[model samples]
Each structure stands twice: as structure tokens, then as C-alpha cells.
Target: MKKAEDAQRLLRTLSTEMPEGWKKDYAGVRNEYRQAMEDAARQAALEINQTDPEVIEQFKKLRDDLFSSLSNHQARWPVLLLSEQRSVEYRQSVQAFEAKHSEFVRFMRQST
Candidate 1:
């Protein structure tokens, strides 16, 4: 999660500092964010596989919600360079992802 946050922060900074060219200039940052998310998802899947069946069942909804939010957030990334409005939408998506992520974390803790 921290990795995701860091990547996102870097992206936010890039967008703010170089809104016109961030996507073309900092493609590496975008890749980093993508890689971090993919890594996190892979780790979560591994953990879910190791968790007890009943516990996993209880978290299915939460896990799905988090992924859904994440997908929405990712979908906004490409359009962020299009307009200020897209950037605003991207930020809102980030907030939604954060909320879903926190909810998922809380449920995971309870599952343990």
C-alpha cells in the first residue's frame, strides 16, 4: 500500500509540475505505479490463497470492492493528460480507491 501511495504521490507531483508533459516525460513513474499495483494485487492474491476458506469467503465482497475501485482509478490515468477536468476526475478516483483500500484493510484485520 505504501508503495502504491508513493507511486501515486509521484504521479500527483508530476501532474502538478508538468501537466502538459508529465505523461510523455515521466512514463517511468506511470510504469512504476502500474508495477506497484500489479505487485500488490499479486501479493493479495497469494495471501488470500493461504487464508482459511471461511475467512476468505467473508472478505470476498471487500476484496472485490477494492479491486473495482482500483480498476476505476487506473482507467482514469490515461485521460488525466487530456484536460484539467480529467485530472480532477483522477483525483476523485484516487480518493475512492483509498476509501475502498481502507475498508478492505479493516476487513482483513478482522479476518485474522
Candidate 2:
């Protein structure tokens, strides 16, 4: 969860503080964010120890949703630095990702 939050912050910084040569910088940020998310997901998998099958399934679904949200946000990166329209779309994608992340966090807290 901390890793995911850090990745989210990194992405927000990348979007808002783009340097002059943004394309090159974006690639590095993108890689970092991807690695962070992967780490977070792995940690989440290891941490979930619910005995109930249904609860386990719920956790799995939430984890999948979180990753799917991250993927959707990542898909917007290339076009995100291109134009105002793309920027708007990118913002929307970020909002969607954050929503999923919040949902995951809430569920995790409840389960724990």
C-alpha cells in the first residue's frame, strides 16, 4: 500500500512537473511507477491470509481491479504529454486509478 501510494505520488509529480525534455523523463518515471506497483501487488498477495474462500476471492478481485486501474492509467502516458486533450484524459485516468486504489485500501483495512 505504501509502495502504491508512492508510485501514485511519483506519477503525479511526473505529470505536473514535466521537464523540458519530457519524453525521456517520462520513460524513467513510467518504469519506476511500474516497478513500484509490481512490488506493491506482490506484497499485497503475500499479506492476504484470510481463511474464508469468499474473502480470499474478494481480495483477489480487489487486487485485480487495482492493477487494472494502474494499467489504464499507464496506457495514457504516451499521449498524456502530447496535448491539452490528452492531458484531460490523463487526469481522468488518474482519477479512476485513484478511486480503485482507495477502494482496495478500504477493503484491506476492513479485512485486517
Give the winner by TM-score. Answer: 2
- On lDDT, the candidate that comes out on top is 2
Assess candidate 1 and give its lDDT.
0.67
Q: Report the C-alpha displacement of residue 104, candidate 1, in angstroms.
A: 3.7
> What is the overall TM-score of model 1 with all chains considered together?
0.59
**1-112 per-residue lDDT for model 2 (tens digits):** 5665676676666567665776566677667766776776666666777567887899889989988877766665663455434556666777888888788878776776
Q: Which stretches in model 1 have alpha-carbon errors above 4 Å? A: 25-28, 48-51, 58-60, 80-90, 105-112
Summarize candidate 1's per-residue lDDT along 1-112 as a digit string, tens digits: 5687687788777766766666675567766766676676556655664547766665677777877776666666664454445556666776788788778766655544
Model 1 root mean square deviation, Cα atoms: 3.7
For model 2, state the Cα shift of residue 71 in Å: 2.0
